[model samples]
Target: MPSSNDSRVERARIVASFGRQFYVRTLDAPGPDRVAVTRGKRTDFCVGDEVTIRLIGADQAVIERGLSRRSELIRSDRYNVKRLAANVDQAAIVIASDPRFSEELLLRMLLACATAEIPALILANKSDLATAWAAIAPRLQVYRDLGYPVIELAARDHPQETRAALSRYLTGHNTILLGESGMGKSTLVNTLVPGAALATREISAALCAGRHTTTFSKWFDLPSETAPSGAIVDSPGFQTFGLAHVSDSQRVHAMPEYTELIGGCRFHNCSHIQEPGCAIRAALESGAIDPIRYLLFSRLAGRD
Candidate 1:
């Protein structure tokens, strides 16, 4: 029996957002239900935000303030930036064999993960597609070689294996699930968190794209035998993951493999493309850097 208050404050987490309304789970409550909350007109909130709220009714609350975020995941377009989730422990990037995997997009995601100081786990879904899987195996290997955890399995076909591989990361941290539409991210979520019942759709063979099933982002708590409190932020599929917030230096720093040669470049502002005595180019030729990655850096940095 909670009462409305003018001065009382309670800690909570924003588990979901709907326009001006937010669904928050109160940490102060003994119950597990969420209460609808609203914030000041200028204040914004995203999934996984820890907030302080004051009760207005039995089932309603007003957010007083959001706690400082430990981490934030954002999506940007040319004009605006959209915060996807906050307090992320890691990013589980899902990709598949069909519709031709985009190496450039994967690199961008990895860069985003790296810049945010979030670890990345690459999952190659649809491994049941033998031909498609075979084609991408080499690229997947490259990611594995670079030290990011990589796992390949069709969620539906290898549920046990997939679960085992993901359990280590999913058991104790708040991971954000990200991928292009039709890449089976929702399906994987369904497999990870039983009773999630997230809607999923098949990829259109004609377009090789999946229907957008998830309309918004929400946090799902994963209760496993090992870690009952682990959670993941499920996000809608993205056609493009924008990095408008990341600066040139941050982008460069995100490339972990390039760290060793960063200060070795001939010029402090060397574009890493067509620059005389560029350390990156030297590393590319010396087999110290992955050629594919260097090419992606060149293109993403807008180098000739």
Candidate 2:
């Protein structure tokens, strides 16, 4: 403990972060940066986690310290607090034909990202069932209109099309792919991982839901050829996500489509609920917005 040398000290900046585990290289050089660091991290760390290192040798370093984040994405945990997924550039909400799209669940996810100002994308998968996509599109228009870049695809059918649509948001950014069971999130993960196979479940037409396969969130690196610079985390699909941490207004702000009507609302305190003279209400009454979505937003926004 009495080493009074620079050999005991090391410092570097975080460039690509995925929760507690992050990849860091040396500050001055390139070619994979000659190093990687991780130090018993249990919470969140992102691309910008400023860290002090414990020098092990010329060949290795350990993250002994971390700086706080400028912003973060988090969802409610059991103890009445939001758990963080630090350094995520965007949250990709995946939806498929069966286990049918839960707009309520979707809104909660969208609000979670919006609370932190993180961009959100809606990936509508399972295009082999074009009829299913058509049936679901009207329900999804809320999220689309709200400004999430909606991507339509089938997990197995068109690799080139899927790659082209998703490649842009994912470049050099750590994104989380999340949705309910049977939504082909695992299929998507399988696509991203080179020679790695993640199990996927099928849907029950009578019940209209997918059998659960994943029990907890796990990380996976995308194929270097497809996502060369950064990686993606395919989180365990959830039945519901808590939105108590973010307000209704903040949720609306996270939604891109609502950008125009946000400040246009008559009342600064508008909940878009029973408030009179509300622009959102006007849109709702005129069928400019989906009622199912409005209902979900009201219920979740009530948490504030």
Candidate 3:
């Protein structure tokens, strides 16, 4: 049994940085002032640790530890094991309406979250544009049909309204901003966190996207009177959030609708593509499955 004080300080913490001299993590201790600082040793810590700590005098100390993470958002970048975020209860996958939205990649990311068994919400940004709203509306509808919550928002304008809609998911859970170059992930994070003025950049014509503003993964604290739930982390601009490490089963399981169709795929080893009796192929042809998503799914399932 845990003590009353022990349970009182059980709010989750996020690993900030592990340096040669010290370790740092983000915590909402002493309520949602978002100023609780957790520090320990390098060997004793790694970035993205969801830990428990107690307030001593001036600093926070690690006390009883929580269970290690059941899953994480990890990917290989240049042969380095880059940890995206830890203890992600959900991911607010951001897609911009500015340069046009690609539902293909969006579905790919949602599938990745499903592969990891994490819930995901799709945030369609740049809704201020008239042309974009029309295109984004259908894309948003498509994801909603797939049973994922979708929101069309413009961060630079209506920050408060967007904040309220997203606040419920961020409480006590780490959320990663998964988006392309120009979708304003960094800007949004800076706004969410009080004093953080993270770097920002504009879309480039040469690449037809926003320039990479964030260089690496960093943690931020959120302001809330209760347990802090508005926290967010900003990651570097990634053109391709590759899913090579995930299994084929994860790719299929990520799509809620595919559960009924996976077993129906032909040959038991059906590639779900070009296989004559593949259920996925038939569904795509009959307009039952979104062709864009099916195409991305086949690629990740190694059928491409």
TM-score of 2: 0.71
Q: Candidate 1 lDDT, tens digit per residue, 202-247?
A: 2122224345567667787887763456898777877777787788
Model 2 poorest ten-residue lDDT run: 198-207
**lDDT of the candidates, in the order given:** 0.78, 0.65, 0.64
Cα lDDT of candidate 3 equals 0.64
- On lDDT, who's better, 1 or 3? 1
Cα lDDT tens digits, model 2, 124-229, are: 9986887777788776665656556888877777767777677777778777777787788867777666544422221122224344465434344466667766
State the number of backbone clashes in model 3.
2
- Measured by TM-score, the strongest candidate is 1
Higher-ranked by TM-score: 1 or 2: 1
**Candidate 1 residue-wise lDDT at 245:** 74
Clashing pairs in 3: 170-229, 171-229
Off by over 4 Å in 2: 1-63, 82-84, 196-212, 215-224, 255-259, 262-267
The candidates, ranked best first by lDDT, are 1, 2, 3
RMSD of 1: 4.8
